[model samples]
Target chain A: MAWVLEDGRPIYAQLVERLQVQIVSGAYPPGGKLPSVRELAAVAAVNPNTMQKAFAELEKSGLIITQGTNGRVVTEDERLIRGSKRRLARRHADAYFAGMEGLGYTRAQAADFLRAAEGKGEAEDE
Target chain B: MNELIEIVGLTKAYDASHIAVNNVSLTLPRGKIIGLLGPNGSGKTTLIKMLNGLLTPTQGSIRIGGQPVGVETKAHVAYLPDRTYLSGNKKVTQILDFFCDFYADFSRERAVGMLQSLGVDPNARMGTLSKGTKEKVQLILVMSREADLYILDEPIAGVDPAARDYILRTILNNYDPNATVLISTHLIGDVEQVLDEVIFMRYGHLVLYTSVDNIRERHGKSVDAYFREVFAC
Candidate 1:
């Protein structure tokens, strides 16, 4: 839900990705109201117009919708959210495997690392 | 909501030999915060003065809201000069009164509210206040006006980092959504985030005028970093 942007990328694109995370992760609950452009821009410390652009992109992606006087709300479409989450996971996995390959690890070794990391997390839980 | 300000072949020279601003043409749309950025003595002040009608342009046309730079445009612009414009002897409250009397858009309530938040005493004499306090007072007066364009010059120059943060936040929060704010400063790092577009100048010639997002995406650098590389000596 927090917005942290690196310098080189377009800010609105980053904002769109961040908002997608918020919506798909249920931090902004389905059918819940979204903050005003000015409010969100202030929070992100970015120009309001830039935030507007991000919101427009999010709306276009079906993650958010405006309901007349109701302003903008997280889409009630559960399938859309689930689909977006899966897509993001796929993109991340692709990048992770690519990075691991660059570091001389095969896909099987990368999967083993993930399993080991998951086992370590369970151990910490105990 | 149309073009708020337009400059066509705008040029300025103190004498026939040396030009301070040279044949710069640009259009500023309504409701955007523009950063006029350049190094020292890059003619930022001269261009601002021409826009405010404080100084006459040598040649070319400058229009605001389709009108030439005259009383009408003057009334529509809220200008914060690089230095204190108010006489040092006047009390802060008296200066506020003067602004209210002169500009129809001036809101005494807004001025007072802004002053209170910045911890500026209205009753204090301008001459007696410290340098930073004076800048805050000037900001309060300028932002009080409901003008269509606000031209702020070196607003963060003299202040400390803490005060600079406050000034940037105030600028972001205060302006009406329809009013265009054009701020001229060399302190790119501090104001880069809030700026929608930036106008880069070098030796009085505009080198670039582009959106911050585009500069970030295309140049692969922060505005400050790009500025350093572009204007590197």
Candidate 2:
């Protein structure tokens, strides 16, 4: 999939978010080697330095580990991945509720709408 | 050694009445891609020409790798002007040969590879090629050099949207890690993501020099958006 980065935010931060989603979705499976900064930067058409900064952030959060000369790899810890997935889902839910609120729906009303949509199979899981 | 290019009180005057670049001082570090952005008649071209030693500065000084802008600096600086300067009568291979003979750092193999990939005919005269094709050839020659600094003026100006992506990627993958690349263009949105920092010029004066991310963080807008606000009429 093409990288979708929004304006008005730091590119490196957006790259970090994209990588997190990829890790949680098994697009970059646990223990898989990550592409080099130059390769990834070229693919995204962004500065390699910015891409490097994003990798450093991912390393700090323990989502990726550097193997010194062997390059970087996704963490092998399944629990950590699950935790990140849960956090991502919660963030999406929050955004959904916020949008619903902007449209004049209360929290309870938004929840009811979601349940009704699910019952009709209109909100199928990806 | 960290700062690859330094300008002190740089000024260029067209005559007694007009000043193109006015008392500008800047220090650019190595190993980064920087944008030199401004609107029309903002002196971006003047500053770039001075850096390449193509035009003389009326006052102040510019140093690349601690050497003043001169013949010595020219050898290490790969420059692509906004317009094509190659002779129209010459074949692409002849221009390639000229670059090979002129710049010791030029890579004939690399230029050939790029020309082949772009499907630019080397045996054809430069006059017969399309404007976009000519720009690609020029870019290939400039980027094939292993220089300390690369100054490109509106490198993406005439290219199509698809070719713009190719040009940006070429810059990203080719530049030496320790060298600095300074690109001057008014199309901020096209090159915003690739820039580490940007220098804004307005009315011959340096207005703002800051990181791309910093602009986004501080102003809650992209560099392109911020530029529009700052340069709005």
**TM-score (all chains, Cα) for each model:** 0.92, 0.97
Highest lDDT scorer: 2
**Decoy 2 TM-score against native:** 0.97
Give the alpha carbon lDDT tens digit for every residue of A13-83 in model 1. 88888888898899999999999888888777778888999999999988999888778999999999999
- Sorted into a CAPRI-style docking class, model 2 comes out as high
lDDT of 1 by residue, B58-131 (tens): 99999999999999999989999998778998999999889989999999999898889888888899999889
Candidate 1, residue B115: lDDT? 88
lDDT of 2: 0.92
Clashing pairs in 2: none
